[model samples]
Target: MIVIKTMEEIMKMKQAGEILAACHKEIAKMIKPGISTMEIDKFAEKFMLDHGATPEQKGYHGYPFATCASVNDVICHGFPSKEMILKDGDIVTVDMVVNLNGWLADSAWSYGVGQVAPQTQKLLDVTKESMYKGIEKAVIGNRIGDISNAIQVYAEAEGFSVVRDFIGHGIGSEMHEEPQVPHYGPAGRGTRLKEGMVLTIEPMLNIGKYHAKVDPDGWTARTVDGSLSAQYEHTLAITADGPFLITKQT
Candidate 1:
C-alpha cells in the first residue's frame, strides 16, 4: 500500500532531508583527485552520525556502505572501496540516504572529478536536467508516469538512455516503500499522485544503451556498452501547492 505521510511525519522527513543535503555538500568538497571512494564513504558516515542522524544505507539488506560511489560506466550501487581512487577526467555519482528520528531522506548527485571530457560534462548536465524535468511532474493529481515520461523524453532527446533495471520509490519511515517510480513511461498512467505522498524521483541516464551488467561483487551495476552514466535525485513531498523538495534547503 502507498503510504501518505502525516504533516508531522513530513516535517520529520524534512529534517532528515536537511542532514542529507549537508552530508552531500561535505562530500562534494572532498571529491577532488587522489581521494579514495572509501575515504568519501568514511567521512559521509561520520558526517551523518555527528549530525545526530544515521546512514540509512549502511547494513541495508546486507549492503555495507554509507554511500554508493558510482564511477564512470558504473551505474549505481557502486561500493566505495579503498582501491577506487578519484582521478582527473573521471565522473562519480554519490548516492546517499539519511535517517533522522525514524524518518528517511534520500538523494544523489553526480560529480566530475578534476577536468572531465566535454562529452562527459554534457552527460552530467543532461542527467541533472532530466531529474528536474521529472520533479516538475511530481505534483498532486499527476500520475507517476508523468514524472517518468518527463525524464525519459528530455533525456532521450539529448541522446541518452534511461536505465530500466532500477528506478525511484516512495520514501518515508523506510528507505524503499510502495509505488515504484520508473524513469520511462507513458504519461498519465501508473498511480495517481496525491498530497502527503513522498517520493524519490531519480533518473539514471546512460551515454549508451540502457542495458546493464552486474559486477562480480554483485553490487556495482555498469553499462553493457561501457558508456558513462550519470544520475541526480531529490526527495520530494506532494502538497496541495505543488512538489516540495524536502532534500533542498529553501
Candidate 2:
C-alpha cells in the first residue's frame, strides 16, 4: 500500500535529508584523483555517525558498505573497494541512505574525479537535468508515469538511454516502500500521486543501450556495452503547491 506521510513525518524526513545532502556535498569536494572509493565510503560513514545519523545502506541485505561508489561503466551498486583507485577523468556515482531517528533520506550523485571527457561530461549534465524534469512532474494528481516519461523524453532526446533494470522507489521509515517509480514509461499511467506521498525520482542514463549486467558479487551493476553511465536522484514529497525536494542541498 502507498503510505501518505503526515506533515510532521515529512518534517522529520527533511531533517534526515539535511544530513544526507551535507554528506554528499562533502563527498563531492573529496572526489579527486588518487582517492579510493573505500576511502569515500569510510568518510561518509563517519560523517553520518558524527551527526547522530546512521548509514542505513551498510549491512542492508548483506551489502557491506556505507556507499555504493559506481565508477565509469558501472551503472549503480558498485562496491567501494580499496583496490579501486580513482584517476583523472574518472566519473563515480556515490549512492547512500541516511537514517535519522528512524526517518530515511536517500540520494545519489555522479561526480567527476578530475577533468572529464566532453562526452562523459554531457552524459552527466543530461542525466542530472532529466532528474529535475522528472521532479517537476512530482505533483499532486499526477501519475508516476508522468514523472517517468519526463525523464525518459529528456534523456533520449539528449542521445542517452534510460536504464530499465533499477528504478526509484518510495522512501520513508523503510528504504523501499510502496509505489515503485520507474524512469521510463507512458505518461498518465501507473500509481496516481497524492499529496504527502514521498518517493525517489532517480534516472540512470547510459551512453549506450539501456541494458545492464550484474557482476558475480550480485550487487554491482554495469553497462552491458561497457559504455559510460550517469545518475542523479532526489527524495521528494508531493505537496499541494508542487514537489518539495527533501534532499535539496543548502
Candidate 3:
C-alpha cells in the first residue's frame, strides 16, 4: 500500500534530510584523491551519529557499512573497503540513509576524485541532469512513469543509458515502500502520484549499455561493459504546489 505522509511527518523527514544533506556537503569537500572509500564511510557514520541521527544503512539486512561507495565502473551498492583507495580521475558515488527520531531520508551523489576525462565528466553531468528532469515530473496527478520517462529520454538522448537492474523507490519510515520508481518506462503508466506521496528519483546512467553484473559479494553492482556509471538522487514529496525536495542541498 502507498503511504501518504502527513504534513507533520513530512516536517520530521525534512529535519532528517537536513542532516543527510549536510553530511553530503562535508563528504564532497573530502572527495579528493588518496582517501579510501572506507574512510569516507567512517566519516559519514560519525557525522550522522554526532548530529543525533543514525546511519540507517549500517546493519541494514546485515549490510555492514555506513555508505555504499560505488567507484567508476561500479554502478551502485559498492562496498567501502580500506584497500580500495581513490586516485585521480576516479568518480565515486556515496549512497546512504539517515534516520532522525523515527523519520528516514535517503540520498546519493557522485563526485570526481580529481581531474576526470571529458567523457567521464559528461556522464556525470548528464546523469545529474536526468535526475532533475525526473524530479520535474514528481507532482500530484502524475504517474511514476512520467518521472521515469523524463529521465530516460534525457539520458538516452545524451548518448548514455539508464540502468535497468536497479531503480528508485518510495521512502519513509521504511527504506523501501510502495510505488517502485523506475528510471525508464512509458510516460503515462505505473502508479499515479498523489499529494503527500514521497519518492526517490535516482537515475543511474552508464557510458555503455544499461546491463549490470553483480560481484560474488552479492552487493557490489558493476557495469557489464566496464564503462563508467554515475548517479544522483533526491528524496522528494508530491505537494499541492509541486514537488518539494526533502534532501535538497543549499
Candidate 4:
C-alpha cells in the first residue's frame, strides 16, 4: 500500500535527511587516495551515531555496512573492503541513510578520487544534474513516471545509460517502502504522486550499457559492460507547493 506522510513525519524525516546529507559530504571529503572503503564505512557509522540518528543501512535487510561503497564498475551495494584501496583517478560512490525520530533519509553521491579524466568528470556532473532534474519533477499532480522521464531524458542527453536492474523506492520508517520509483519510464505513467509522499529517486547511469550483474556476494551490483558508472540520490517529498528535497538543511 502507498503511504502518505504527515507534516510532522516529514519534519522528522527532514532531520534524518540532514544527517544523511552530512554523512555524504563527510564521505566525499574522505574519498582520497590511500584510504580504505571500510574505514570510510566506520567513520559513517560513528558520524550518524554522533548526530543522534541511526545508520539505517548497517543491519538493513542484511546489508552489513553503514554505507554502500560502490567503486568504479561497481554499480551499487559494493561492500566496503580493507583490501581495496582508493587510488588516484578512481570513481567512488557512497550511499548513505540515517533514521532519526522514526523516519529514514537516504542519499548517494559519486566523486573522483583525485584528478580524473575530463570525460569522467562529465559523467559525474551529468549524473548529479540528472538527480536534481528528477527531483524537480517530484511534485504533486504528477505521476512517478514524470520524475523518471526527466532523469532519462537528461541522462541520455549526456550519452549515459540508466540502469534498469534496480530502481529507487519509498522511504520512511523503513529503509525501503512501497511505490517503486524508476529512473527510466514514460511521463504520466505509474502511480500518481501526491502531497506528503516521500521517495528516493536515484538514477544510476553507466558510461556504457545499462545492464548490470550482481556479485556472488549477492549485494554488490556492477555494470555488465565494465564501464564506469555514477549515481546520486535524494529522499524527496511531494509538497502542496512544490517538491521538498528532504535530505538537506535547505
lDDT on C-alpha atoms for all candidate structures: 0.93, 0.95, 0.95, 0.90
For every model in order, what is the number of clashing pairs?
0, 0, 0, 0
Could you tell which candidate, 2 or 4, scores higher by TM-score? 2
Answer with 1 or 2, whichever has the higher lDDT: 2
lDDT of candidate 4 at residue 21, scale 0 to 100: 81
Query: Model 3's lDDT to the true fold?
Result: 0.95
Worst 10 residues of 2 by lDDT: 135-144
Error of 4 at 57 (Å): 1.1
Cα lDDT tens digits, model 1, 1-250, are: 9999988899999999999898888888898999999999999999999999999999998999999999999999999999999999999999999999899999999999999999899999999999999999998889999999999999999999999999999999999998999999899999999999999999999989999999998899999999999999999999988998999844
Expressed as tens digits, the lDDT of each residue in 1-250 for candidate 2 is 9899998999999999999999999998999999999999999999999999999999999999999999999999999999999999999999999999999999999998899999999999999999999999998888999999999999999999999999999999999999999999899999999999999989999999999999999999999999999999999999998999999988
TM-score of each: 0.98, 0.99, 0.99, 0.97
lDDT of 2: 0.95
Local accuracy of candidate 3 as per-residue lDDT tens digits, 1-250: 9999998899899999999999999999999999999999999999999999999999998999999999999999999999999999999999999999989999999999899999999999999999999999998898999999999999999999999999999989999999899999899999999999999989999999899999999899999999999999999999998999999999
lDDT measured at residue 148 in model 4 versus the true structure, 0 to 100: 93
Deviation in Å, model 3, residue 17 alpha carbon:
0.5
lDDT of 4 by residue, 1-250 (tens): 8789999999999988888887777777788999999999899999999989888788877888998999999999999999889999899998888888778999988989989988889999999999889988888888889999999999998899999998999988988888999999899899998888899989999999999999999999999989999998888888998888898633
Model 1 / residue 148 / CA error / Å: 0.6
lDDT value, residue 168 of candidate 3: 91
